[model samples]
Target: MAYLTQPDYVKYICSCGQLKPITSLYFCRHCLKIRCGFCICHEVDSHYCANCLENMPSSEARLKKNRCTSCFDCPSCFHTLSIRATLVQPRQASTEASGDAKVENKQAKKMYYLSCFNCRWTSRDVGIPDQPVASGGWPERTNPFTTRMNQLLEYYKAIALQEKQEKLERERKKFAIRGKYITLTDKTGLTGAMARNIAGLPSTDGGSSSAIANFVASQASEEVEELPEDVYTKEVNLKQITSMAQRLASPEWQPAEVSRLHPLAKLLSVKRSQRCRACDHNLTKPEYNPGSIKFKIELLAYYHVPEVKIISHESMKPGEKAALLVKLTNPTGHEMTIKLLQPEDVPIVEEEEQKSIEKSLEKSLNLEKDSYSWRAICRPASYSALCRVREVTRDFTLAQRDDAAEYDDDARHDADDVIVWRKSNKLALRLEVETEASAASGAPARAALALQYSYRNTVPPAGNQPHQRNHTLYTTVLLDLGHVI
Candidate 1:
């Protein structure tokens, strides 16, 4: 028999039907099947300050609450204090004669103060005890707002939830009375109340009078559930909490201006996740850290806007029609609709034989520079003379601007990136011609190509974002002069 490899030890199935690496999956012998970080429970084995790394026993840790005993947040700005120490000279126990005798003294102990540079907060200023070590010796503080804020927040949350339940009940009744269909509960031999109970919601058929009275009693009670004493001991200093509240409430406050900060702030920003590559179960969040780890969340900046640009064809023969193209792209994560318009001077026209070229040329040609001239004759010499050119435009969308974005403007002339030329809106010209007809035999031809393009983009604001106009107009045209061939 041939021995088989362990079938990729890293690849394993979790209880939640998600395929994840063994590194990300944990084995729960009790649960049998593989357990991923997402499906398993997280119980903190110990409580310790990140700065001190001194693990404390559960019972003792509970006594001081979960917070570190030696550390404290700045009351003014809530930043962790950095302990600093200085050495001092020790005095001898007995005095020695200046020149006759001398005595050896013991080494002196140094004292230092911990300070918060961001908020100018200091431990010495608040009367915290000095520690032998420079780090891991901070004082802990308790927040006074803890009780009131918790009570207020819970009260509003409960009120909102109760309102939602009431609205859902009304909607259910309306749909039920329609009689067009039977609900799953009705077909399963269960009443709506029974289903609601199974779903963990309170029964809705209690007497109106009793329900109203019960609701009133519940709302009148202001008491909030108390946290476990051990958890409760993890108190936040009132001063620090107050400072944070003020900063949050002030519209003018900027995070850049605030100084004091916890050292682990960046570590908290690291996003750790365990995902089941196969099933994508617990789809919203396949991996989550235990409640013990206090994770931090923040928004940096939003990137959502459409980008656009234009390109023009190189200089063409004096009598030939010039062509140009415009490209638009959406650099944002969302899709966008856009519109483009041709410049006023560059009107859309169809190809046609030249008409009254003599009159048109007479109006455009400059007599002062008429040393030479050039002319374009249609395949059939009988065709009418060409006088002006026509313009054209198109529309499209671009996906997110990732690393692959590339810009190509090879067709544009060296003189200018933009161009503008006049033409009839309804009629297309075979081509526009501006040549110096020789006042005498064969003169030299010299003329400039003038072109310009104009356009508009339409995009809607994202949800709840304030209505604001955001679009840019790029206008530039090139004028190149060359000898007529």
Candidate 2:
């Protein structure tokens, strides 16, 4: 018989080709195979401005390119630009006392500029003027490339028109083979010259005007509207100014100009991506939005580190405690904090071996470790010829039966919630095994131990917001033991 604190059997080979515990393998149904972080591809799709919720399409993105029209980066450090405001006393009218004094306007309402506090990059640096009010109502600037852009746009339009004409010509020829295939002009009792005259397509260019005149005729009308001066006035006083501005304006602030900042700075962008170091696989892409503190997560199939092993045990008498030891290590440079997320929180593995046991014991273990942690799970696997397994236990250590909180829908899952609490690398545990006379023929029985850990990745997101959010890492450890009870 199997006892509590012990598993019935352990798996030998990982779903991947490597020999690892059932815990260390990730089952991928889409690929119908086990995958380690070593094999996958990751790519970034787009970087958007969160405040405006205006995402740029990739093609348009390449041209507008360096800076977003709606979004601005600090010119000094290139960090995402945040809006800031200052209240001015509005120059007080100085000649108010004299009866014959000239009338003075209310202290020419003071004008303050909106600027970036991080790198001393002011809206003024990019020629962004101050607003009359604290928020909104900033002047919009037309692009300087308007003329060249218009020409390019027209060129594409013309090309599209030419392609359409060619397609129509092809269709006409295809249909010509069906019968007499008389041309439209032939059926209508007209020749090519007559048809060209009727269709409005020029057969010759001898009488045409200058190319510039033709271009002018084909071009759309241009109209420019200017905003009234009153529209630039700041009607409302902006009360809250963040400390970021003061920090940015401080003379002490210095940011590195190297490309190394690319990985970290990209996190500030609405959409961020990172490539794996081992295989250069892109592991996570998050949609970072400034207006809201929520984000979208896209976890790639690769990049899951794994652990697998085989455990053996002797015969088991009823009610005896057994123990198994498994070790975990991080292969990446950045610190990774972990927890044992519920099985539902993890993606399903598609292997048949993974599905053999339905409802295998599992639970979330609240953790508190920073880069690494250790804990134990207690279970009994004796009488039913089946093994009982539980999730990796951390500090939370709930009982066998208790209701736990379900994961909330917040776009941001706090990093502090799932870390494990461990002062040292070592962890201790006890397992009990029981045996029955029928199976006491002296043959050793076997059981499997499954362990899971959920961790937070230290890598930063790819776009503008480097510190926006954290990526959760999940891994499993498996051990199998056989011996007498």
Candidate lDDT scores, in order, read 0.39, 0.41
TM-score of model number 1: 0.30
Runs in model 2 deviating more than 4 A are 1-48, 51-70, 91-110, 124-128, 140-145, 164-485
Estimate, for each residue in 13-94, the C-alpha lDDT of model 2 and write its tens digit: 3333344333433334222333433222234456565545566666766665423554454434556666665655655465
Native-to-model Cα distance after best TM-score fit, residue 59 in candidate 1, in Å? 24
Candidate 2 at 159: error in angstroms?
1.1
Q: Where is model 1 more than 4 Å wrong at Cα?
A: 1-113, 117-121, 131-137, 177-182, 187-485
**lDDT by residue for model 1 (304-336), tens:** 222222333334344454443333334444434
lDDT of 1: 0.39
